[model samples]
Target: MSRHDLQPKADQPHVVRATVGWDRPLQTFFAQVFFRTEDEPDEGEALIWLGTEPGEMLTPEAVIAVVAPHVEMPPDLAERLNAEMRQTTGMKDGRHQAAAKRSLFGSIH
Candidate 1:
């Protein structure tokens, strides 16, 4: 899965979208993550703004790296996903091979 929000509010975000899926053709697992915010357009109305970073293909490790620094994550989960982003960042092709790596999430398949 690939996802990117039009704009992301790292300071005070109101929404977070994250998902994981297997890319059969790529022979790997992929992940997507995005952050957004809600605004009041009128009285008693919440307008969701989808303005954020240009979504791009990121490995599960990369997703966690981006998120961990900006938000408070569960201790166990954060430690796990953030395992190798430091070393693997910007290396998409190599990341795909790490599909068998560990994560807090599991495949439904």
Candidate 2:
């Protein structure tokens, strides 16, 4: 059967899809933060389902905070990530970037 044919019917709970990215070395960290399990696909990436309806997207800082307590990372990494994210997202400074990096990378070393 085709992939669609195998899916649950419309009456079933709707599934939301999201794409998350991380460095290859941080695969386990990402899985732990997002999935709560170490079992991850081999693609070195993750697709998560938050909910059916549109929900507030987690700020990068939020993501970092959620994941930070669970893993080990260097302090500089978090700082650098924050800087990059700030530049990319047009945030005023490293504040949000640091938060997002911490969320994705976990605790700094």
Candidate 3:
């Protein structure tokens, strides 16, 4: 099973977007994460933005390490969001893998 297949279902708020790429100016990977919640879940905020590094898998550990300091989400809730992202996106569903490939390789695949 692909990593995307392990991602959690869309029952609650989850990471809707995750991207990582080269940052020429910074000479490092740039990672971005966007998690969606039902109607202003976080103090009237509908979406949460989190951290990154290019080429590295956007693991929950990484998210916690990077985003936790900036965001004030409960530990359990953050874990849930991380699980959702992993279960949904990390598990490669062929489609996501293709998209990931495109994102990383620029249509080379």
lDDT of each: 0.37, 0.32, 0.40
lDDT of 3 at 64: 50
Report the lDDT tens digits of candidate 3 across residue range 1-109: 1111122224433644333333221123333545555763443341433332333434545545544433344446445545454444423336665676578657523
Tens digits of per-residue lDDT for model 2 on 17-69?
Answer: 12222221221112122222235432222234221121232233434454344
Question: Which of candidates 2 and 3 is the stronger one according to lDDT?
Answer: 3
lDDT of 1 at 17: 40
The per-candidate count of clashes, in order, stands at 5, 10, 11
lDDT of 1 by residue, 1-109 (tens): 2322222335645535443333332333344443343443222122322212223423445544554444454445434434433434444434433443322123222
Which stretches in model 2 have alpha-carbon errors above 4 Å? 1-60, 89-109
- State in Å the error of residue 95, model 1: 26
Ranking, TM-score, top scorer first: 3, 2, 1
- At residue 11, candidate 1 shows an lDDT of 61
- The alpha-carbon deviation from the true structure for residue 99 of candidate 2, after best TM-score superposition, in angstroms, is 30
Best by TM-score: 3
